[model samples]
Target: MELFGTEGYVNVSVKKICDEAGLTQRYFYESFPDRVNLLAAVYQHCVDIARSATIAAATEVIDRAGVADGPVPAAVIPILAEEALGGFINSLVEDPRRARVILIEVVGVAPEIEKLRLGAIHDWADLIAGFASNGRPTTPKQKLAAIGLVGAITQLLVDWQMALTDPINEQAGPDLFQVDSVHEVVTEMFVATYDKIFG
Candidate 1:
């Protein structure tokens, strides 16, 4: 996303990314079977970074709030929110063409990428579901909700792309870069859903 934005899907050869990353074609091929695999790896790497950042942020938040030893409160949703927003905005800031590639091209003619991307989402959902507050409803229910919420946020990115009624809408600002606003909004909804049924 930092180099190409969403349109990176079209004509975004691995050679280019490798060239930018200062690696050779042989190494690229050795690392990734194809572009799809490479794309998946990129997604995974970014998601992992976001997850770690989220956990650290959550840990800090809890510690600052002075609840270090107790049963960790339900936090997977907030973490996901932070990840989603950051992912979307950072991708845009890193590469305007990345969004096109990630949200659009990767899903087309690239089952491998889709597999990795969707699997990542499911993994996040699984984490969220598994880590809900104690005595919560069945895990399946939480997983289902998590999956839907993630999908909704993902679609929201696509929606923003569609809403841009310009030939070249690439003027995103620094405000979005600080936090994932879309995720921030959606996380509240999920939190409320959990509170209503489980609180």
Candidate 2:
């Protein structure tokens, strides 16, 4: 997983993967049937990491804001939005390898991973809907918009990652490496959109 995430899916060979882990090819085969299987494992691993991080962060916000048993206070929404987005974005930013795996490496890898990816997208959309509706039931249009929001977020992250690698984009400034600018803008957008849709 580490090898695939860092070196890229296509560039990582079984032998290289094994060597990176200081293991033999025999050990690799024993664990994973093949490279694609290893990739599937990596993809699932990243998804799990992302899910856990986002859930934990959101749960903290809910608990800390004392919204566990009653209606969430409007005052808590910005905090919730910022913390939740911070959780998701930091999960990727803190480890560029995981970002690479999620934002780049897993595309069209295999049927199994693709299935997981699609499911993850829906799950993220559900999360977004929760934010928009503030625990109220989401209308079909809201649900569709939630999905579109997730897609937009993904594209933004992809572009951000691309900028990190491209020399031309790097010339913009050092702030590009820091995600808070993007995070702040996203949080504001989310708050405004949520209020607009279900204010």
Instruction: Give the winner by TM-score.
Output: 2
Q: What is the alpha-carbon RMSD of candidate 2 to the true structure?
A: 2.4
Residue lDDT tens for model 2, 1-199: 6777667889988899888899999998999999988887777788788878887888899999877877667778778878888889989988889988888888888887788788889999898788658678999888887787778778767767767765345554445634677778778877776777756
Model 1 lDDT tens row, 5-59: 5335456787788888899999988887887676666666666665565456556
Candidate 2 C-alpha error for residue 163, in Å:
1.1
Roughly what TM-score does model 1 have, to 2 decimal places?
A: 0.67
TM-score of each model, in listed order: 0.67, 0.86
Q: Where does model 1 exceed 4 Å of error?
A: 1-7, 18-24, 72-105, 135-138, 161-184
Clashes of each: 16, 0
Q: Where does candidate 2 stray beyond 4 Å?
A: 167-178
